[model samples]
Target: MTSILIADDHGIVREGLKRLLEAESDFEVCAEAADGREVLEQVERTHPDVVVLDVTMPRLGGLETLEHLRAAHPDVKVVLLSVHGEPPVVQSAAALGVHGYVLKNGCATEVVSAVRAVTEGGSYFSPSVARQLVEQLRAPRAEIPDPLGALSGREREVLKLIAEGLSAKEIGQQLSISAKTVEAHRTSLMRKLGVRKATELVRVAVRYGVIEV
Candidate 1:
C-alpha cells in the first residue's frame, strides 16, 4: 500500500481530498495536516510515502516545506497542488525537485495520477502547468518575473494573510509571531512593493499570484 499524507489549510478541502484518495484501494491516508508546520510534524510522525501538499497554507508555505522535506526526507515524493498555475510558481517547484504539479481546478483523477506517478519514480504535471513550463523553457531566462521573490518567506506568508483580510493579530496568531512582528512584515511588504495602502497590497498580492482572487 502507498501511504499518503494530505495537507491543506481548509479542513473541508482536506476531508474532501482524504475521501477521494482513500477511495483508491492501494492508497492509505496516513495523516492530515492543516498547515505546513503541521505537515512537517505529521511527516515526521507518520512517514508517508507521498505528500499531497497545498501551495498556500499558513505558517510555512508548500515551497518552504518542500525545501525542508528534500533536505530531511529525500526519499519521500511530493505532489504540489495550487489554484495558481503561474510560471514562476511552477518553475520554483520544479527547481526544488517536486515530483508532480497538479492545479486545484483540475479533475480529481489528476491528483490520484500524480500520487501514483511520483511513487513509481516518474513525474506528472497538469496540462496547464505543463504548458507553462514549456513556455518558461522556451522563453528567455529573465522573461518571467516573480514579484514575491524579493520578500522573505515569512513576509510572503504575512502578505498572503493580509490579502485574505486577516488582521495583524490574526496573522500573528496563525504564524505564532507577535502582532508587532506581523505589522513589521506588513510595513516591509508595502515598502518593498512600493505600495502606500493595504488595498494596494491586496491588488499587488492578487496580481503577483501571492494569493488567489
Candidate 2:
C-alpha cells in the first residue's frame, strides 16, 4: 500500500482528501496534519510514503516545510498543493525538488495521479501549471523589471499581507511583529516599489502576480 499523509490547514480539506485517497485500494490515508509542525510530527510518527502538502498554512509555509523534509526525510515523496499557479512560486517548488505540483482547483484524479507518479519515482505537474511553465520558457527573455526582487523577505511578506487587505496591526499580529515594525515594512515596500499610496502598492503587487487577484 502507498501510505499517504495529507497536510492542510483546513479540516474539511484534510477530511475530503483523506476520503478521496482512502477510496483507492492501493492508497492509504496514514495521517493528516493541520499545519507544518503537525506534518513533521506525523512524518516522524507514521513515516508515510507520500505527503500531500498545502503551500500556504498558518505556521511554517509549505516551501520551508519541503526544505526541511528534503534534508531530514529524503525518502518520502511530496506533492505540493496550492491555489497560486504563479511562475515564481511554482519554480521555487520545482527547484526545491518537489515531486509533484498540483493546483487546488485540479480535479481529484489529478491529485491521485500526482501521488501515484511521485511515489513511482516520476513527477507530475497539473495541466495548467505545465502550460504556464512552458509558456514562460518559450517567451522571449526581456529585461522586464522585477519589483519583488528589490524587496527584502520581510518586506515581501508585508506586501502580500497588505495586498490581502490586512492592516498593519493585523499583519504584525500574524507575523509576530509589532505594529510599528509592520508600518515600517509597509513604508519600505512603498518606497521600493515607488508607489505613493497603498492602492498603488496593491496594484503593483497584482501586476507582478505577487498576490492573486
Candidate 3:
C-alpha cells in the first residue's frame, strides 16, 4: 500500500481528505497533522511515502515546511493543496520542486490522481494550475516583482504578528527579540511595503498572503 500523511489545520478538512484517500484501494492513511511543525514530526515518525499538505497552517506554513522536507527527506513526494492558483504562488511551489500542485477548489479526484502520478515518478497539476505554469513559461522571463520578496524573514514574522493584532512588545517576546528591534522591523516593513501607517501594514500583509483574512 502507498503510505500517506495528511496535514491541514482544519479538522474537518483533514478528516474529509483522510476518508477520501483511504477509499483508494492502493492507498493507506498512515498519519495526520494539524500544522507544519506536526507535519515534520509525523513525517519523521511515520516516514510516509507521500505527503498531502495544505499551503496554509498555524506554524511553519506549507512552503517553509517543504523546504525542510526537501533537505531532510528528498526522496519523499509532496503534493500541495492550496487555495491560491496565482502564477507567482504556483511558480514558487514549482521552483521549490514540489511534485504536485492541486487547488483546494479542484475536483477531489485530482488529489488522488496527483498522489498516484507522483508515486509512479510523474508529476501532476490542477488544470488551472497547469495553464498558469504554461502561460508563465510562454511569457518573457522578465522578473515578476514579488510583493513579499522584498521583506526579510524577520520582517515577515513581524508582519504576520502585526496583522494578527499583536503589539510590538508581545511580538518581541515571542521572537525573543527586544521591543525596539521589533519596532525597527515594523519600520522596515512599512518602508518596503510603501505604507506609512501601521494599519496600512496590515493591509499589505493581507495582500501578500502574509496573513489570512
Candidate 4:
C-alpha cells in the first residue's frame, strides 16, 4: 500500500482528498495535517510514502516545508498542490526537487496520478503546469538577479516577520532577540533588498513567496 499524508490548511479540502484517495485500494491515507509544521510532525510520526502538500499554510509555507523535507526526509515523495500555475512558483518548486506539481483546480484524477507516478520514482505535472514549464523552456531566457539568494537565513526570517506585520519588538520577542537587534536586521534587509521602506520590503517578500498575499 502507498501510505500518504495530506497537508492542507482547509479541512474540507483535506477531507475531499482523503476520500478520493481512499477509494483506491492501493492508496492509504495515513495522516493529515492542517499546516506545514503539522505536516512535518506527521511525516516524522507516520513516515508516509507520499505527501500531498498545499502551497499556502499557517506557520510554514509549502515551499519552505518542501525544503526542510528534502534535507530531512529525502526518501519521501512530495506532490505539491497549489492554486498557482505561475512560472516562478512552478519553477521554484521544481528547483526544490518536488516530485510533482498539481494545480488545485485540475481534475481529481490528476492528483491520484501524480501521487502514483512520484511513488514509482517518476514525476508528474498538471497539464497546465506542464505547458507553462514547457513554454518557459522554449522562450528566450534572460539573466535575472535572484534577490532571494542575496538574503541570509536570519534576514529571510526577519523579512517574513515583517511581511506578517509584526513590529520590531514583537519580532524580537518571537525570535528571542533584542528589539534593537531586530531593527539592525531590518536595516540590513532593506539594504540587501535595495528597498528604502518597510512597504517595499514586504512587497519583495510577497513576490518571492516569503509570505502569502
Q: Estimate each model's TM-score.
A: 0.82, 0.71, 0.86, 0.84
User: TM-score: which candidate is best?
Assistant: 3
User: Which pairs clash in the backbone of model 2?
Assistant: none
Q: Which residue pairs in model 1 clash with each other?
A: none
Best by lDDT: 1
By summed lDDT, which 10 consecutive residues of candidate 3 come out lowest? 144-153
Clash pairs, model 4 backbone: none
How much lDDT does each candidate structure score? 0.87, 0.82, 0.85, 0.86
TM match of model 4 to true structure: 0.84
TM-score of 3: 0.86
TM-score of 2: 0.71
Tens-digit lDDT track of model 2 for 1-213: 999999998899999898888888999999999977789999999999999999875455676678789889999999999887877677667667899999988798889999999988999999998887677677774643345556655676677678888888999998899999998888888888888987888887666555555
Report the candidate with higher TM-score, 3 versus 4: 3
When sorted by lDDT, best at the front, the candidate numbers are: 1, 4, 3, 2
**lDDT: the better of candidates 1 and 2:** 1
**Over the stretch 1-213, how does candidate 1's per-residue lDDT look in tens digits?**
999999999999989999999999999999999888899999999999999999887777888888789889999999999997877678778888899999989899999999999999999999999988888778887767656656776787788888899998999998899999998998899888888987799988777566666
Lowest lDDT block of 10, candidate 4: 143-152
Q: Determine the C-alpha RMSD for candidate 1 after optimal superposition of all C-alphas.
A: 2.8
- Put down candidate 3 lDDT per residue, 121-150, tens digits, no spaces: 999999998988887788777756456656
